[model samples]
Target: MNNAPQPHHHLSSDEIDLFELFHAIWKRKKWLIGCTLFAGLLGVGYAYLAPQVYQVSSVLRPAAINELDALNRSEVYKLPPVDALAKVGARLESYEARLSFFRANPALFEAFQRPGQSLEQSFEAFNKNAINLTFPDPKNVDALNGAIRLEMQYPKGVDGVAILNGFVDYAIKLEREQVSADLKVIVNNRLNEIKGKIDAARANYETDKQSKIARLLEADKLKRAQLEDELSAVRLQMKVERSNRLVELAEAISIAKSIGIKSPTTPSALGAAASRGSSQVMRTEVNNQKIPLYFMGTDVLEAERTALEQRTNDDFTDGRVAEIRKELRMLDVNREVEVLKSRSKEDIFLRDVEPLWAEEARLRGLDIDMSGLKLVTIDRMAQTPLSPIKPFKAIIIGLSLVAGLMLGALIALIGHFVQARRENGPFPMPDRHLPHPQKHTH
Candidate 1:
């Protein structure tokens, strides 16, 4: 025997099922074709119904090579080095610094916020919402504040989606300027603080000096007037005393001369035989007494006048009022200080910071001078067609048709099996063949 169970004398379950499928297709060809058509149409519709989108990429770098030294701080007398330079060490990377600018300075943030029908307009519109800008929520603000992050990786040719490019470049430049402005604000606040202190100190100094000077001047004037009066009176009194002393001395001298008082007996008894024989003879003859009276009264008067003048000079020349004079002199010195105090004005330490503050204050009205930020184009303005840059309509439709055909064939196969089973009646079974034949033989 060939064995193998004689190959079952017919087909197994797989072969039988395959033959059934083959037979069903032949019988229900119309239905199978119809299902295939449906599936093909479905696939065709899907492929063509998808929407198309275009995307553009841009590249930008942070503002570089800013001439920070161009800003002048030379005249500032007391500014700290950092304050003078207005350098916070490139804090533009810190969203916080920029955030503060946006929060504190509306116009500043607004300028950064892209405007008018732009890809970035979503950020700008938020500025109008008072709640958003007024009370910053970092979660909400991070995206808005993110400096323009340009993607320069791909060279999407000149026809690229360049719409968002200019704004982004402009934005980064604005940011650099804004950062510089923020630094300036810091410097300004510091300078203002020093200015305030200097002003207050000056005002206070002026106040104190003025008060003391006025008082000192008044006292000096009063003292000088009083001294003048006293001196005049003293002079008159001195003159009178001098005259009296002179008169008294002159009268005494006159009396002495008239009485011949100078002829007293020679205490050096006959020390010199008196004027020899004449002396003895003349003395006895007429008692000749010659009074030494050459302007004796006038000499006494002159001596009296000299003594009085000496006393007046001594009294007037003494440094008795030195303190008052010194006080007056001090007042005069402080007067100059007061003039400076009154005339002096506060200096603007961060000159450029002012426009920044104003720009920050009035965003729409920004006359911001970005010249100082020293911006350069690391990535020049260039455009490329947006990707899926070239829309291959033909290729897309071709792919669509191929996919549709396959889907259609698969649907047709399943539908054909369903319709064929119904048409062929229930599954076949072997004939009974009047099975009793075996019983009868038995």
Candidate 2:
């Protein structure tokens, strides 16, 4: 009979022995408990030793339409609440703005300093993850509300609330100053434009006035020349009439000397002498012819001729010459042109001046002080948090215990395999199912 140990028919190579596997694990129960306790203690120590981080956040919303009414009415700047919120969001996210805030307030970030890190390096670390900005989703229905959230995370002993509030105020103030500067520039540019128009209008008015004066002066000169010509013609006519009178007197003197008349005689006197002898006979002849010039005595004719030859000034003799001279004196200066040239207030006389001045006054009167302007409304202000946000004790302990249990189980399995290999052969049969080695009775 063959006495070698025979393998059990019920047990197969693929089948695992549950009793033996449990027995092996049970043998190393002390190790599993020790590892679990050690891992739990480590978790507890880490939970207690890590720095506690606190979070503070604030909510901001767009201002109401009425809040921006003054700015819109001024027409200098038209900013809507949505755009204002966007600007605030931009400022909140700017790295430079954050750095500026950090520099401005040194006490708030003093806790971030480390031993070997420079101030700038510490700030860089803080700036990397400390500030968080959240904006409303555009795809959502409430996007028109234009709400934004600002969050700050800092280690223990840091004043995140004050820093956030101060940064918000600073951003708004900076935006207000920028708006004011832009408004001032626009207003000044408009004022300059109005001034230029006013100046151009005044210049045009002055030129027109000068042209009017020149025209008046030219007309005055023409009138004076006409009067002078009339005066000269009248003087020449008087001189020629005087010479004709002299000739007539000389002819009349010769005729009187030949006819032997010695005194001035009228035509009526000659007619009466011829009709004096025929009063009753009534045989008189009617003659319409005037008496000849020789009938006047030479003494009167000679006296008139002497006066004509001696007259030097014809202006005194003729009324027309005196009138012409008076007119020429009147035309020497234009009163209308003088009045225009001597005017002191030329603006009143200018056309389209009222509108320009009115616009200028309106621009000058605009309110550029936007300090009181409401850019954003703080829905919620940041407050000190009650608890820290890091190092969850329960979760850490639970996960560490689970990991330790797994490691202990792997070690027990490895030890069990090595003992089994040493006790039996390299390929050991199932411990429980293998028949005991029968005594070999030969």
| Local distance difference test, each candidate | 0.45, 0.83
Question: Which consecutive 10 residues in model 2 have the weakest lDDT in total?
Answer: 277-286
Question: Candidate 2's residue-wise lDDT over 128-225, tens digit each?
Answer: 89978999999999898868999998888888889888888888887777777878898899899999999999999999999999889999898999
Predicted model with the maximum lDDT: 2
After the best TM-score superposition of candidate 2, give how far the Cα of residue 37 lies from its true spot, in angstroms. 2.0
What is candidate 1's lDDT per residue for 274-318, written digit by digit as tens? 545446432332335563332344445446546755564434433
Per-residue lDDT, model 2, residue 48, is 82
